[model samples]
Target chain A: MPLVDIQLIEGVFTEAQKKGMIEKVTDAMVEIEGEAMRGVTWVRVQEFRSGAWGIGGKGLTTEDVRALTS
Target chain B: MPLVDIQLIEGVFTEAQKKGMIEKVTDAMVEIEGEAMRGVTWVRVQEFRSGAWGIGGKGLTTEDVRALTS
Candidate 1:
């Protein structure tokens, strides 16, 4: 039961899509283990406006991180 | 602003507490950015039964990850 956190910029999903995404993510976790998901809580998805975020004291966008990660 | 997603076990928060936790997490993101928060979304929390989770093909707990991180 490893707590996994995923952060992303907003607007990538709709209400239903969000539900699906959450389920999918959970599914991935469950795939690794049978009953691994239990008593889990979702904090929130924070959407930062431009200039509201930075990397190493320099402004960076979620796209930037996605690019870096991808 | 990197999209950050936090997944945790349920019951650590109440409805009101969940709201606060969400806000606090958001605040942290915004602190790194002023207008960086906008258009976000929250999916859902998944709880798995025992024997449902594993690490490296063996059962593991969220506390284990927390311990590793801490």
Candidate 2:
């Protein structure tokens, strides 16, 4: 069973976006691991507070993510 | 760097429980992968909506989880 967890800054995505991510991730895992594992694939989307995510001694906020995505 | 994600039914665990799980899971990964990986290990505890978790043709809800843990 492949469990996929995606972490993102809170308030950035809609429910629809999260659902899409889950479906796509599950499809990718099934494509790699085989169809037998499809039913057991679990995908979760977690949101962290703004400024709670750090990378290379820098904390990232929704503004940082928005700048990149926008 | 290893990312460990734990999935559980919602409402069954307290914040402390989830934090404990994160710490223990991180420690487990570090124990197997080596000490250098400890700093980069990302552990997340995800809670699914009740009745959202499925296993072997059965859907598990918070009630079922509570029953088991109780």
Chain A superposition TM-score per model: 0.49, 0.87
Candidate 1: lDDT of A67?
49
Please give, for residues A1-70, the per-residue lDDT of candidate 2 as tens digits. 6667677887777666666776777777778888898788776666788889899978898889888888
What candidate 2 gets wrong by more than 4 Å, as runs, is B1-7, B12-70
Query: DockQ of each model against the real complex?
Result: 0.15, 0.12
Return the top candidate by TM-score: 2
Best by lDDT: 2
Task: Find the candidate with the highest DockQ and give its number.
Answer: 1
Give the alpha carbon lDDT tens digit for every residue of A1-70 in model 1. 3354655555433465445444554454443333323334233334555445665797655556444433
After TM-score superposition, what is the CA distance of residue B6 in candidate 2 from its true location, in Å? Answer: 7.1
Query: Lowest lDDT 10-mer window, candidate 2 chain B?
Result: B51-60
**Candidate 1 local accuracy as lDDT?**
0.44
Q: How does model 2 fare in lDDT?
A: 0.76
* Model 1 bad stretches (over 4 Å): A36-44, A56-70, B1-70
